[model samples]
Target: MSKQKRNTHSPELKAKVALEAVRGLKTANEIAQEFGVHPVQVGQWKKALLADSASLFDKKRGPKPKPEYQSDEKLYGEIGRLKMELDWLKKKSGINLP
Candidate 1:
């Protein structure tokens, strides 16, 4: 027999189902049936969801996100290109006059 392909759920859907699972609205088997997936998958999602949620409330949060900056090589390359274009324009148009 051929293998069965399972449908992938989005992060939002997973969170929703996990939240529902946390709320004790229905059994894992029922939720699995509702979402057309297996009970074990829902159980795993619920476990992960709770773990991450608990982390958010934990006192020891990690360091703040670092600011991303442009690389020096890229900036220098852009500056070089601009300077070359300016020089080319100066050669073609002559010096700036009063």
Candidate 2:
């Protein structure tokens, strides 16, 4: 028995077909035939594009906000290391910092 692999279209091709459908320049059946896909597939892609089109403009146009990933324990460890180095330098110089 021979197994047949399913056809997977690239994102670019799907976008092209969906855009054509949205433009009303071609019917779903015509777009599907031209794109070598099923009519149902063309309709699905068009619906998905239309549904998600609003999100394209909904995003803010600026640099993304960075996440605060620093932990309190990590910060405390850095402070402790700096304090130890300062104390060592003071002892070596024979200078008291009270």
Candidate 3:
């Protein structure tokens, strides 16, 4: 027996199905049958949409906060230290560099 390839649905189609599920106008089985997807998938999408909807309005307007651990001075110092170690190793190994 040959294995059947799984079908991939587009984001738009998923949104439509989820929206329909949220509206409660039709049952999950009906929505799944109409959209050619499993009822579980429809329920999952609806749950995800509802969960993320709050974050849509919670976003703050302005530049995002910078991370605490990142600094240009620290990065440059690390690079210089690495270069010195590499040079020391090369000289000790008698590897000539032009």
Candidate that scores best on lDDT: 3
Poorly placed runs, candidate 2 (over 4 Å): 65-98
lDDT for model 1 = 0.85
Clashing pairs in 1: none
Stretch of 10 with least lDDT, candidate 1: 64-73
Judging by TM-score against the true structure, name the best candidate: 3
- Alpha carbon lDDT of each predicted model: 0.85, 0.92, 0.93
What is the alpha-carbon lDDT for the whole of candidate 2?
0.92
In terms of TM-score, how similar is model 3 to the real structure?
Answer: 0.66
The C-alpha local distance difference test score for the whole of candidate 3 amounts to 0.93
> What would the per-residue lDDT of candidate 2 be over residues 1-98, giving only the tens digit for each residue?
99999999999999999999999988888999998999999999999999999999989988877655656677888999999999999999999888
User: Backbone clashes in each candidate structure, one number apiece?
Assistant: 0, 0, 0
- Who is ahead in lDDT, 1 or 3? 3
**Which tens-of-lDDT digit does each residue in 1-98 have in candidate 1?**
89998788899989878887888989999998888778998899999998898777676668865545656677889999999998888889998733
The TM-score of candidate 2 is 0.62
TM for every model, in the order presented, reads 0.52, 0.62, 0.66
- In order of TM-score, best first, we have 3, 2, 1
